[model samples]
Target chain A: MNQSRNRLVFLALILLGIGFVALVRSTVNEYILSIINFVGIYIILAVSLNITNGFTGLFSLGHPGFMAIGGYVTAILTFPVSRKSMFLELPQWLANLEMPFFPASIIGGVCAAMMALVVGLPVLRLRGHYLAVATLGFLIIVQVLITNWDSVTRGPLGLNGLPAITNLWYVYPWVVVTVYVAWKIKFSSYGRSMLSIREDDMAAQCLGVNLFRTRVAALVIGAFFAGIAGGLWAHLVTAITPTSFSLILAFYIVVMVVVGGAGSISGAFIAAIIFSVLTEIFRPLEENLDVYGIGEIFTAAILILILIYRPQGLFGSREPGFLLTRDTQ
Target chain B: MASSNSVLLKVEGLEKRFGGIIALADYDVEIRPGELVGLIGPNGAGKTTVFNLLSGVLKPNQGRIVFNGQDITRLRPDQNAALGIARTFQNIRIFKELSVIDNVKVAFHIRMGHGFWKTLMHTSDYRYSENEMEQKSHEILELFDLEAIKDQPAKNLPYGIQRRVEIARAMATMPKLLLLDEPSAGLNTGETDELVKTLRKIHDTYGLTIFIVEHDMKLIMTICQRIQVIDRGRMLSTGTPEDVRHDQRVIEAYLGKSGHGKQYAQG
Candidate 1:
């Protein structure tokens, strides 16, 4: 009871932080708010995907595909029912609809998870690089279909003029929930089973782990979160192209997970924030400096250096709780 | 291990073949409750094959394995494990990347009832199970004198200690039937002696029906209550250690009638 109470107190503190952010509307500028929102979205996607790829040892590269499902689904639902002129390529059924934000977002997430269940069958059968390639193909297939499917989606022209509904209030609560869930998994027995599978599949199976079931559960749960992140992105940016959720975006999310520490949940969050900040700092240099491709070149270089120097990433497999190092003992 | 009347495992006509190589043609053994059975033979004596078949690693061509009075022939490997069959490999197969604590934690997985939802939610069920696994793993590690290296990655441990860690891992499953393949292999004499003592301690404390495959005659002779000798995929004889020591067929099986087995007897 005492431990539960202490944990509840800790969660209250986290919720207070989110509430505090919600109140500081005048002091925080839109530019800083944008960066905060971006970090939240990245953290959600990276940490959620880490649950599967890192902890469960399922190399899924189709996270962007799930996000695409969320983005398209949410965009379809929340578009203004009277705004037909805004969607030239949208079908009559979707253009004539307008649903509230929260329900639409959740439904979007649900659809993405269902799509994951469909894809996970053949994809999870392949291990290591084969599974990765198969999932990458799913991402490409999603992107190409979004670009060409003129009826429901806007096709290559893309969905536009989505309502900007995600504020700091909208994002930080979701972050707390997602991080709470991921961290819990890391310290739990199920988490240990997943880690065991990552270390040795045959041994884990011999120990009574249902290999296929665990992998699919991890993948589907991760996809649900990815979808939720996509819905948040759609509302925050108010527009999305098939190109936004691309293979490159997938690479960036994976980089965040890796540099944060692949198997570390809290590390994923830290890596997301650090990478999001670095991208923002480099945004202007890569944009107006006429340096052309040097910006991406440097980013790739830093990733290579990280892999060589600290392949386990900043935290390795350790979490933020052991940041003081003394607690590690 | 239960009372002697419990009848833990009964194997009859367990046969295996590897593309015309007959590993075990007609293997029969009855492991009673709480009995320590020694499996001995010359090189390629099909001892390991028996261990593999019982532990569900290798399926026999023809056999009936009545485990706990249940016919588990076509069960999944983990299902066999859930029925209280745990094994250690001849070549050590520890989870190399996991810490010594986690190596045992993985073994207690089936005993943990927490699911993905429970884990992700940090429910009481998850916390209780995790704490139980940690305490059990720590205790098992201490038994093998591995408490000092409990936090160390498994691969970093020395080879001999690694083997002890392997046995500790198998025991963490709380198995009713523990199959060990060459537990004394590669251990120095002092280590082998300690290994024998540890095996005895485990049998006494946990009461697991242990079936061990060992090449060391001295170790098996000292540790086992009953010795079963197998030669060329056939059982030579099985009896009390004193009876096996005097059995002529068992002598021919081990010393080849030219007579290393007789050398021990006549001397």
Candidate 2:
């Protein structure tokens, strides 16, 4: 009872923090609310990806590919009828189309999840290097498809004039719910089995874990959330481009999980926020100092520093509830 | 306990080949209920391969596996597990990164009754299941004398204790049959003796039907009620420990007619 109460108090504290931030945004003309919104989206993506990559021990390099599918689908589906009407080069069917925002967003997420399942069925059966290469190849294939497909994706020209619908209201609640779901999973038996599989697949298999089913479950789940994050990103930016969800995005998500601590869900949460803030704080520098790909250089340097210094990001594998002695399970 | 004279596991003309070499060929054995059966063979005798096939890790290009009187040839490994068959590895295989208790809890996952929503909601059923698994894992660990180290990471335990924990984790699932591969391997004489005692106690106490692959003949002779001797993947003979000890065919299979197999066995 005390532990459950502690969890409640912690949840209250997190809500308090988010409320304080939103209050501050409403009170002051601060420029960082957008950064926090980005952090929430990345947190959703990072925590979701960690479910598969960290917990299930599946090296999924196609996260950005799935995210891209979600972003593009949601962006196109939620494109206001006015904008759709304006694009003459677009198909007559698309120009006359109108998709309600929320349902379109969820459909976008489901599309991405379905893509994950379709790809995962064959790709996830492999192990180690083979799995990595297969996912990486899938990412490249998706990117190429998005770039070359002119009718729906608008080719390299990309889609623009999307509604900026993600605000403090949408992001905070979504982040909380996603983290809570992930926390529940981490403590649940499915989570335990997934973690055991991470530790040793052969051992887990002997203990009644179906490897294919487990991996697919984790993959579909993680991809579903990543897709949701993509929906948020598509609306928040008011533009959709293939380049946004690319290999570089994949690398960043990996950094969020690795620097956070592969086995730690909260680690991903904290690291995503920190990394997202750092990227924004350094954005001007990145734009001006594009000297020899300074953005990659800066990210690589931060990653190296984290690896050499903190090792397990801010939270490690210890959950916030455990830090407060709330729940043991 | 005598194996009810009723077959639990049957292998017939089972063969495994790796490219140019045949690892197991024309192997057959039957394990019955409530029997402490020993599978003993030389290093290259394909004893482990037989275990692998029975456990459904490797598919025989052709063969049928019937468990609990149900044909399960096409069943996956987890399906085999659900049907009350559990196995340990020849080399220690545990979820080394997890706590010992958590390792056992993982084995009890199929017992979960709650859906994803219940888990997500942290419902009463979810909490009950989690606590039940933890308590049961603790109880089983205690039974194996592993309670003190339940919080310890599995890899940190000593080899003998790790083996015991593996069996304990397997038993946590309440399997009808247990397969232990080299459970006594890498143990000192003292550890092996304790292992034999533990095995005998578990068999007598729980009435567990166990099939073990061990090179430790002393432990086998002391505890296993029956021994199956195999050479070149074919069963040389199956009998009581004493009967197999005197069988000339078993002697020649292990001794290669050098006339020193019995002396080697006495250690």
Candidate 3:
């Protein structure tokens, strides 16, 4: 009975997604559609980062590095031959390459996951703040490399004039997939093991959880989604650069996860949508009203207020169902 | 009575040190199958250290710990668990945020057959294993009289109940040998009596070789068939409970060597 209900809910979601795609495609205002697309991408980023930071209790600030890897890889792969020759200094075989957005984004995700595996082996061993600092260092290193690698990345000039392939059709499906995967894993034994590690490492280990292996797996999975989000963001903007994935973007994603409650997938999704909309709403206030940095100040205020009032974030490590009823009590 | 030749655990010359302080030195222990053994000593006597070494929470500088038939001296905690040895902590270490049922289900993780893909997709095999685990967890919870409160977070339970849940969680691993560290530490006399009954019932039902480190002399004396005494990281005595209770060296270690110390034993 529960399985059939789950299937019903999944079927309803797919139908809703189809309707949403049609709605966005027929909408006349491009600005609203763009905002919706950005929200979808942020949802993926926030939810994926929550898998490691919130669920596994591994505080990582390396999402920007993985995003940079994904964004650049997808951008390079999907760039037209004429555009690549005009901007990028590349090998003959490589310069002539082009692929569809779907496959390029997947390869971008794979590349990011591979990097996560390599970086996670050593960094995941560090606990708490040390782990956070090491990952932050990784983001900085990636940015620096991108800034200096002129032949491949065009150095500080950045890459532009790529196809604007990210829309509701591309972004919404990934949003659904990300939420579906996160929700499924959150209820599975693998998720329970991750949560156990978060609660208590020694006890979790005594319960037969391989700490390093679980931690690494969470990082790889989270990185894969972050990479995909980056690819989407790059195509939506039709440009790519090292600065696109700076510490600031990483901090915003982390804020979304924390403000949504780290371990709660629904919390991340809601928080991402709310924050993205707020950013857009406040954009006019900052630009038209000439209030420089007003949007950032407002975001900081909201975060601080949320921290003081509800330290566990809006959901406090609980699923959205918890709000429908007091099941825990 | 079990034969002395059918040994389940054998630890020889276990020595551990932390910089200048000797935590445990030249410790030797043996437990026959179906035996309930107790290791008792005063504070800082390395009782918990022995448990740490046996469960692979810490490695001894010198020792050979053989459990069942495997040399587990250098094994990791999860590896030791996989080899059919499980333990609880001195301080209650139940996963506080998880429900009572989940705390037990976590222990059943090692035996779970479903891989990542199957679990994510909720394949039929995954459903079967998960249902089996839930049924088994419920049975264990029922055995501990915790089934009613199984859905509540473990930390929300009372201290005595929390202790019971910890042991129940340990039992969910289906261990051949169980090591309990100060299981009766926070319990009152009534709770201690209940704990003793539960331990005996668990031992009998599971046919497990049980080793315990405890300070509650009453619980130990009432349940344990044999007792090993340690003081300042050295072995003081090893004998039947009645024998150790009457031994001069064991009495001396707990009550001191002087005649004035007799009051402690009586008290």
Candidate 4:
């Protein structure tokens, strides 16, 4: 009976969130609404990255690469059929193909997941700095491919003026899904294995946790969500370039996961919102003060301070007590 | 000696080398079901190497490991564990950030055979399995006398309890063969005595076959039905405690020539 009440309360809370999104969508100014959308996108990215870098203890810089793949796939599939033929020469079947944003986004995510499986098979073998470098290499390779694939990607200048369909409704549901899935996995046996791998992989393997499979699964799952976030981001801005998914974006996402708490889902979600809001607030302030790179400096300083004082991030590897109410199961 | 079919673990002519150095050579061990065997060696007699080979951490350069009538020589660590061979490390490797119960719960990974979608969906299958996991984890904690401190982070525990947690985690795997690499390495006499009792209780209760490597002569002599002594990566003697204590070579290589032998005799 008590559990049923908790579930009812949880459902009411979710409905309240949806209503809140609707209220903001109607009442908020365009600038603030854009910021909210950005928050939702970052939540997806940070939470997804946590699966690989935080939970599985892999140091990957390939998130932006997966995002790029997702964004391009969604854009191409959802592009106006008339616009598709005018901008660049796509293959015959792809040229005529037009899809809805939802299915296109899913396809983008699937493509990214497929790429992760291929890349992770070999790259996941490396650990520590080597793994980081290998993933960074993957990011670079992705950028280079997008830049050089002139006919398909239109060279360095990427697909532009995509339909602006990414609103709070779309971004909000994805945000909820990403967090919900990550939360579920985090609290399950699979999540325990991921945590064990992060703590001591050799020990995890000795206990019958398949190290390779678990690590790759983390990467693939993270990549899939990253792909979706990319599609959302591309539509929100209505533009995407090969240079858009740069090392800086990768670094920022890593900072969010690290600052929030690696293994804590709520930590990543909260950190994403905090950092996104901070960056937006700093942007106008920096422009008024004419201080270029001040935002980067501030975030870096915060990161360093966090490392020195509280190396485990805000929540460490645990959730807050309120969020852990149903933990008895 | 036991027939091949009766043995739970059969190792034959196991050999390993690190570059030019021979860490283990021509080692053989046969552990029958329900037997508690001990491996004793000096500091660098490759006792850990044997554990590594058996647990599939290191692929033996030359050997065959047959577990339950199937050859497991080329299996990976996780595969060996799934096949009912679980091991504890010489250095405690419990997940320090996790609670004591969570540490033990990690060992149930292989047995919790559910799909990722089920895990993510929180379906009835997931709820049922998670409940089962919680109950089993609690039972293990109770067996190890850790039920009271199950919620405490493993890192905050005393050294002896951390050791016990590692053993308890290994027990959660429900393996037919348990490879314990120095269970009483850093324990005091009292703690070692307590661990000996725990080992005996679990072995008799579950009919577990345990193969332990330890430097503690008293712990091994008191609990192990058969003990194998190695020197310079080769098997020196295998027999009852009394036979190994009286062997002239064991005295010279391990227990020391005369005075140390007397000290061992006193035990």
Candidate 5:
């Protein structure tokens, strides 16, 4: 009885949130709207990354590689056929093809998920710092590939003038979807398997959680959403570059998940928004002072402080009391 | 059911080695269904090696293991679990940060039977199985007298309760054979006594086969119907607890003194 009531209340809250997004879309200036769009994308990235790093305890840094795949795929599919033909050479079918944003975004995500499956099969065997390094290597490999594939990616120059179809309406729904799916997985049997693997993998195996299969599943699922975020990001910026999805962006997403509390969805949500807004707020200030990377330096300092004092992340793997509809623990 | 006389688990000429050192050699065991058996040995006696082989934690450089008439010598630990073998570690390994109930519910993963998409979509099967898991996990927790602290994280519980929770989690797997490795390792005398009751009650109530490794001689003698002794990786003796207690070799190799058996017997 109480569960149904909570569901009703949650539905109302979601409706109100969408209405608020619509209000901001109409009232806010372009600069503020862009920051809000960035927040939505970061929320997608941080919450999805939490599945692999937070729940499964697989310290991966390859999120940007998956994002790059999604971004490039979506950009290619959605690029105007006239622009595609004029900018670079392509195969007859792909050069002639132009798609709208929605299906192109989904295909980009699917492509990313497929790549994760291929990489995860062997790399997921590693653990801890070794896994982290392996994933970082993957990200670097992706960058080099994009840089060298001149025919398809236009080398270091990258593709530009992508249609700006990514707005609050497009990004916000994906944000809601990513967080909802992550929350559902967190409370499901698969979530339990992932958590058990994190705690003690040997014990999880003895109790019948297929260790390799669950690890790969977490990575694949996380990669799919990252791909979608990449699509949204490529469209929002109206351009794509090989260096755009860099190690810096990867580290920023990791920081959000870590400082938000790795295993807590609400924590990731709050952290992503706070860090995104803070970075945006610091950007103009850094420009005015002619100092570079002030935003990054400030984020690093805050990360260190959180590590020293709140090592479990801000929420310690549980939601705060107000977010609790039931006993999550 | 396989006939009552048929062996539930059969091991023949099992051997394991680490570099130049031998962990076990020519080790053999045959356990009929529903037996309460104990493996007792000194430190470095390869007692755990035997459990490791049986549970598929380590591949044997050796012989065959047949459980319920299927060869399981080469199966992995997860496969062994799916085949109805469950075990607890000598070092307690409950999911420390998870609630006690979640620890038990995790064991039901194999039997939950719903796939990823069903869970994501919150299909009817997902909700039904989840409800079933919650009720069943609570029932198992109640069996171990852990219901009062079900909501508390496993790490916050006393060592005794944590130990019981490990066993409770194993039982939730609904294993046909349960292997316990030094279950009394960190328990005090009072806690050990409580565990003795719990093990016996589980064995009696469920008719489940139990194989235990123990340094606690009282736990072995008080509860185990049959005992197997190993010293330096070879079987020293196997018999009823009373018969094995008086064996001369067991006293010298295991008890280390003739008086030790009498002390444990009286205790």
Candidate 6:
């Protein structure tokens, strides 16, 4: 009976999502539609980062590096052949290549996950602030590498005028997938081990949890989705640059996770939408209203207030379902 | 007493040093299957160090640790757990943020039968394994009378209850040898008596080989059949509780080298 009820809820959610997508696509106002699309992308980023930072209790600040990897990989794969040729530094074999958005994004995500696997092996061993610093260093390294790599990345000028392939349709599905995967992981045995490590590493290890393997797995999974979010962002803006995936962007993503309550996927989703919308609404104020940097200052203030008043964030790590339902069964 | 032939754990010539100070030196112990042993020493006697070494929290500089006939001297903590050893901490280390049931479920992680794909897809195999884990966790919780508070966060529980949850979590790992460090450290006399009853019940039900490091003499003396005493990182005496109770070295270690040793030994 419970399984049937769950299936019913799943079907309803899919139908609702399709209806919402149709409504957004049919709407004539492009600006509002783009803002909604950005929210979906941020949701993906926040939820994925939460898997590592909140669920696994690893304070990683390397999402921007993985995003840059995804953005560049997708941009390179999907860029028109005619435009690709404009870059004289591009290799002859690569300059003519162009692929569908689907395959490019998949490759982008896979590439980011691969990087996470390589870096996480050594870096995930460090805890707390050290891990954060190490991951931030990774971001810096990626940024520097991208800045220096003149042939593919266009030497910090970044790729521009790429196909506008991302929309609400492309992004919302990825959000659903990210949320689903994260929710599944949170309840799984592996996720339990991760949580135990977060609570007490020595106790977790003594309970047969392989610390290195679990930490690395969390990082890789998180990187995979962050990469996908990057692909969506690159396509939505029709541009890619090293500065696009900066430390500031990483901070925004971290703030989303913190404000959403780290371990709660629903919390991340809600916080992502609210913060993205708030930033967009404040963007015009910063430009036309002569209040430069107001959006950033406001966000920083909100983050500080939330940390001071609700250290566990809005939801305090409890899932929406858990809050609604009293009994576990 | 169980025969030496059925020994579940054997430690020999164990040595650990933190710079100049020797934390443990020439530490030796043998625990047979189904034997309840107590390791007692005053502050800085390396009682907790022995637990740490046995459970693979720390590696000994010179030693051989054989557990269930396997040499686990260089094994990591997870490897030790996989080889049928589990432990609790001197300080309560339950996952405070997690639910009481989840505290036990996390320990059951090693035994989960589902793969990553099954878990992500929520396949029937995943459900089956999850249900089994929950049932097992419930059973363990029930054993500690924690079923009523199973849904509460572990941190919300009282100290005594949190200690019980830690033991339940440790047991969920399905260990053959259980090492508990100061399980009764912060409990009141009433809680300590209840803990003794619970420990006795756990030992009898699981038929486990338990090695406990405790400062509470009354609790350890009542429960442990044989006790090992250490002083300043060296073995002072090893015998039954009654024998150790009256041993001159054990008495001297606890009451000092004055006439109080004899006076205390009389008790």
- Note each model's CA RMSD in angstroms: 3.7, 2.3, 2.1, 1.7, 1.6, 1.7
User: For each candidate, what TM-score against the reference?
Assistant: 0.87, 0.94, 0.96, 0.97, 0.97, 0.97
Model 4 scores a C-alpha lDDT of 0.91
Model 6 lDDT tens row, B1-267: 456588899999999998999999999998899999999988999998899899898999999999888999999999999888999998999898999999999988888746557788888878888888988998998898999989898999999989899999999999999999999989998999889999999999988889999888888888999999999999999999989988888888888888877665544
Chain B only, TM-score of each candidate: 0.94, 0.93, 0.96, 0.96, 0.95, 0.95
Which interface RMSD does candidate 2 score? 1.7
DockQ of predictions, in order shown: 0.56, 0.69, 0.62, 0.75, 0.77, 0.74
Docking quality tier of model 3: medium
CAPRI rating of model 5? medium
lDDT of each: 0.82, 0.82, 0.88, 0.91, 0.91, 0.89
Worst 10 residues of 5 chain A by lDDT: A320-329
- Cα deviation in Å at residue B184, candidate 1? 2.8
Considering chain A alone, report the TM-score of candidate 3 relative to the true chain A. 0.96
What does DockQ come to for candidate 6? 0.74
**Candidate 5 lDDT, tens digit per residue, B1-267?**
346798999999999999988899999888888988999987889999999999999999989999999999999999999999999999999999899999999999898846679988888889899889988988898888999999898999999989999999999999999999999998998999899999988998899999999998878988888999999989999999888877788878855666775555334
Query: In model 6, which regions exceed 4 Å deviation?
Result: A88-93, A322-329, B1-4, B113-115, B262-267
Give the better candidate number (3 or 6) by lDDT: 6
Judging by DockQ, tell me the better candidate of 1 and 5.
5
> Which candidate model has the greater TM-score, 2 or 6?
6
Which residue pairs collide in model 6, if any?
Answer: none
Ranking by DockQ: 5, 4, 6, 2, 3, 1
Task: Tell me the lDDT of model 4 at A185.
Answer: 83
Model 2 reproduces what portion of true contacts? Answer: 0.73
lDDT of 3 by residue, A193-276 (tens): 888899898888887888889999999999999899889999999998889998888878888988999798889989999988
TM-score of 5: 0.97
- TM-score, first chain, each model: 0.92, 0.91, 0.96, 0.97, 0.98, 0.96
State residue B241's C-alpha deviation in candidate 5, in Å.
Answer: 1.6
Overall local distance difference test of candidate 1: 0.82
The residue pairs in collision within model 1 are none
Interface RMSD of each: 1.8, 1.7, 1.9, 1.6, 1.1, 1.6
